[model samples]
Every structure is written in structure tokens, then in C-alpha cells.
Target: MKAKNGLNYESNPKHTPGGQGFRPNAGIEPVNSFELFGESVSVNLKDKIHKSRYTMDNKGNIHRFSPDNRGNYHWSGSTADKIKLNIPN
Candidate 1:
């Protein structure tokens, strides 16, 4: 099966027992930098299983990155309205 974004989901060998799979088709991208709360933050928004993950910086500020209903990824703590990432299929 193919997702709207053009990612193939049929018999993905990368699918693991933990429900986490890597999207090989969507080549990995470098960490993205964005401004949050008037400060620069580094967010690693890679394509992977649709799961919620959290990270914290040395300052103790927490950041959340998760998938939405459409399978697009977004990050929290950003001043912008919504930074949605739609990896190419």
C-alpha cells in the first residue's frame, strides 16, 4: 500500500516488533533549526514510525515531536503556528 505522500507501506522490512519502522524512501535529513520562544532550537525530525518522542536540552526545556492524523510530523514549543513536515513519498 502506498500513503498519500507516496511512501510504500506494503511489506516494509524495516518494520520492527516495537512498531517502529524506518522510511527508507524518505531519505534522512539533517537536523532542522527553528526559532522557538525567541531562541534557536535544533529539532531532529526524521522519518520513522508514527510515535511520540520527547527531548530536552541542557536548559531543561522539553520538546515534543509527533505525527498527526495525516501522518505529517510536527514539533511543539515553536512560536510559529504549526511546523508541519510532509516527507515526500
Candidate 2:
């Protein structure tokens, strides 16, 4: 489905049994959302924001996380810093 940040954040058409592909059975994904603030901003302020987070954790399932709750999440130790990863692509 079309997401807030203009991405086709859809599930994998070929759902493999052991693949890390998406499961679009739900709605769109979060990383496909938009970023509202910069590193100079604060995390406390950003955490209160809604409509920006796409993933959900119910029961025991956990989706990926974007530090500061922005649209950029690094897979644990994927980087040394989260804010710096937002270097204009």
C-alpha cells in the first residue's frame, strides 16, 4: 500500500517460510513513514508523536525500531549513531 513517505511499503508477494520479507497481511510498514524532526531536536518530544509510527508489538512480536522514533531505525549495532545516519541521501 502507499505510505506517508511515498513508498510501496507492501508485504512480500512471495512469502517464503524462512524469508525476512514483509508480511503485508497488515498495513504498511513504519520505516516507509516520514521523518518529522532532526537530530538537533530531542527524542522526548518526538516520542509523543503519533501517526508516524507504523510498526506494532502485540503479544510477543516486535517490529523494527527507529531510534528517536523517527523513520530511520538501525538494526542493533548497525551503526554507532542513529542521528548521523540521516545524512541526506
Candidate 3:
């Protein structure tokens, strides 16, 4: 059957038109909130690595924070506003 997007769902509903399978939250970890820079920020455990951290603001914008050589965290950059964690504090 053809889906509304014109993709053949009969073959595999899990895949899209280009054959890329849909994996919801594929590599995403649970979201946790933390107080960073005096503001409540939501962070994905998956984005927390040894060198950097990723946080989401209230407007669903992603911001990257990394530590300097002196071990002070600073805003690195902003990422695409795709993932939103609306979990309450």
C-alpha cells in the first residue's frame, strides 16, 4: 500500500522511501535536568561525553557546552532544534 507520503508501505512500513529504516530514539539516552550557569538545562545522557556536553533550553534549542583546559565549562555552539525534552523538574 502506498502511504500518504507516496512511499510503498507494503514492502516495509519501517523504512522510508529512500530505504532508511525508522529507529525512534535510536541512540538517544534518557534525558536528565541539571543546573548549569544558574539555569535549568535538560541534557541527554547520550550527548554527555568525556569532552563535551549537550543541553536543551526551554524553547527546544540545543546548546553545546564544553570545558576549557582549566576545567571551566563554556558555551561551545548551538545545534539544530530537533530534539526537545519537556520533562518537568
Put the candidates in lDDT order, highest first: 3, 1, 2
The pairs that clash in candidate 1 are none
lDDT of every predicted structure (CA atoms): 0.35, 0.29, 0.38
In model 2, the runs with Cα more than 4 Å from the true position are: 4-6, 16-54, 64-89
lDDT of 3 at 47: 54
Model 1 per-residue lDDT tens digits across residues 1-89: 33333432222222222335654433222233122212322344555443543444455545444445674444433212133233322
lDDT of 2 by residue, 1-89 (tens): 33344432333322223446534332233232222111112223345643222232333222332343433432211112232222111
Worst 10 residues of 3 by lDDT: 7-16
Clashes of 3: 0
Q: Predictions ranked by TM-score, top down?
A: 3, 1, 2
Inter-residue clash pairs, candidate 3: none
| TM-score winner | 3
Report the lDDT of model 1 for residue 21. Answer: 61
Clashing pairs in model 2, backbone N/Cα/C closer than 3 A: none
Q: Say which candidate scores most in lDDT.
A: 3
TM-score of 3: 0.36
- Model 3 score (lDDT): 0.38
